[model samples]
Target: MMIIKMDDNQKLGENDHRRLGQELDLFVFSDLVGAGLPLFTPRGTVLRDELLRFSEELQAKYGYQKVFIPHITKDELYKRSGHWDKFGEELFLVKSQETKDQMVLKPMNCPHHIQIYASKPRSYRELPIRYMESTVQYRDEKKGELAGLVRVRAISIDDAHVFCTLDQIEQEFTTIMNMIKEMYRVFDMKFRARLSFRDDSDAYIGDAADWEAAQRTIEEVTKKLDLHYDIAEGDAAFYGPKIDIMVTDSLGREWQCATEQLDFVMPKRFGLAYVDSDGSEKTPVMIHKALLGSFERFLSVYLEHTEGRFPLWLAPEQVRIIALKDDANILKMAKDVVKKAKEMGLRAELDDDNETVAKKILAADQMRV
Candidate 1:
């Protein structure tokens, strides 16, 4: 519901992600696969994998352990986490003939991660436990709301969750904020912070006191980090308040790519607890975060931001050696260059097809090689 002015100086017709995606042969849409679901080609897969690897590397440096969860879960799980009540209409329900369990495709990963944290009794020594995952989440998006990759049913999120005590909230938030900053800096994007808070409405979960405490924590951390932010009422998630990172693309358009939320509701709802220093059970606070809100959506913004001219580290094909003519010696030389580049751990390829040099060059330029 929030709006910001977009740059009218740049023409998007040529740099549109959908058009570039087709021209570059990165991904495709098949009618048989259903709407809002994209199939990435080999080159597209390479780009996605490289981005994921970078995110993982950053997470590893911060002591985050990778975790995995199932794509589907029992309906009871969401019901307990309050997602069923909040997003019931958007859930994709499934039935199994062999069992009486009610199942649905998971639309979020927090509840699953909560189960892991609750798997064993925790001591204060393990107060700040961080888990990270890059996985696809399914949502039954309205057909009319679906667009290219920006709004899709299959969304890939680089999600992380931190289960820490109240005292650890500030430091945990600072760590996540630094990661977000580094990521956007690497992409050469400028961003600001939006303090998304809840309004006086029955739509939100948890007590007013809990909500106030969570929002206070978020604001304190924001101020501590000297972040420039504006408070947006009624924009908070049903469970908590969030510091949403609003990235400004090269087109002067703002996109919400990263978020760090402070949650005191979900942990209590799921009865997640850890033993305190006093040997008393205390509910741990949950922080839900996403560095790249959704890979598909991020790629859509970044593709247009750079007009498909990806940096060398992220490009699917880093080097493309072209033979000037059909001479055997020229072809051999081009092959040797490609092999050398590959040996140096670069994504290199040879364009030795029997085609004109001009045509090959044009093709490579179009593909942003």
Candidate 2:
């Protein structure tokens, strides 16, 4: 294989995603079509499907129910959740074609998940309900800050929401932490937890006591689990505190992976309540979580972390069956191998060229095929 070397100063470099993305034939951005959006090619589509599969397998083992929601929501929905008021500057709003009714692209999935919880009356027995989905979300990111897949306007998230009572909060959070650990472990990446708390900033919400309580809760949970973590102020959400996983890449850059936020306002605003064991109506505590955060962000992080050398488990083209001889028999065997590999759920392809074995390996390495 062709080995590439770099100087110490340029070591690991930027990973030059634009160049690599083109070489891999994954996705592209066009200024003519508008900025901050991407068009995924066939290979990119395959990669996204693999990511979805990874999320599904993990959710299944964690007893999460997969759910689908519409991309558009009524203006009132966001209004109730206070996103329209708080995040209006970053939202994309539209008027319905037929009814001229106001609608907006969903920026987050927690509001939708809360509506599902409020759809019907729930009992204390259903205290810890976890709903998961891999849905496309949007934001009006500044053009200047937008980059390839890493920073995009329209993105999909491996998001989930856990509705549980206060009594079950610690247990549920622990379970979600374990879920994040499993995801990181699968990618074989080392990670640290960041307890993101609100600072004395204008964007923070709730009282200082409330924020401290939430932060303390997460810190205590991590401590109890013996998970190593660092505390970061001013990294919290406007509505609550969160725990963000900071993973160090091969290049030693830290990226925020999984996130678990304890939200007290969204559920209250949406009027999400259930009958408690004591037979009193109580609001269910909502936990906003994403094991992989934004699929776009996670993929970009993983791509750089591995330096485009993805492990076989997540490699877009896991195997390339190339024919050593151009004879009919060899071609047929290559085709057969491709079919068998696909049937076994491996992402394999038949390279149909007369390139030497070494040359083919070098090409695959570059394309991350």
Evaluated at residue 335, the lDDT of candidate 2 is 99
- For all predictions, the C-alpha RMSD in Å is 4.2, 3.5
lDDT of 1 by residue, 1-369 (tens): 222322453334777887788778898988899999999998999989999889989988998999999999999999999999999999999987779789999999999999999999999899799999999999999988988899999999989999999999999999999999899999999999999999998899898998998888889899998889999999999999999999999989999999999999999998899999999999999999999899999999999999899999999888899888889888888888988999999999899888998999998998899
- Model 2: CA > 4 A from native: 1-14, 207-209, 356-358
Q: Rate the local accuracy (lDDT) of all candidates.
A: 0.92, 0.83
Query: What 10-residue stretch in candidate 1 is worst by lDDT?
Result: 1-10
lDDT of 1: 0.92
The residue-level lDDT of candidate 2 at 354 comes to 84
Model 2 over residues 339-359: C-alpha lDDT tens digits? 999999998998878888888
Per candidate, the number of residue pairs that clash is 0, 0
Residue 204, model 2: Cα distance from true site in angstroms: 3.3
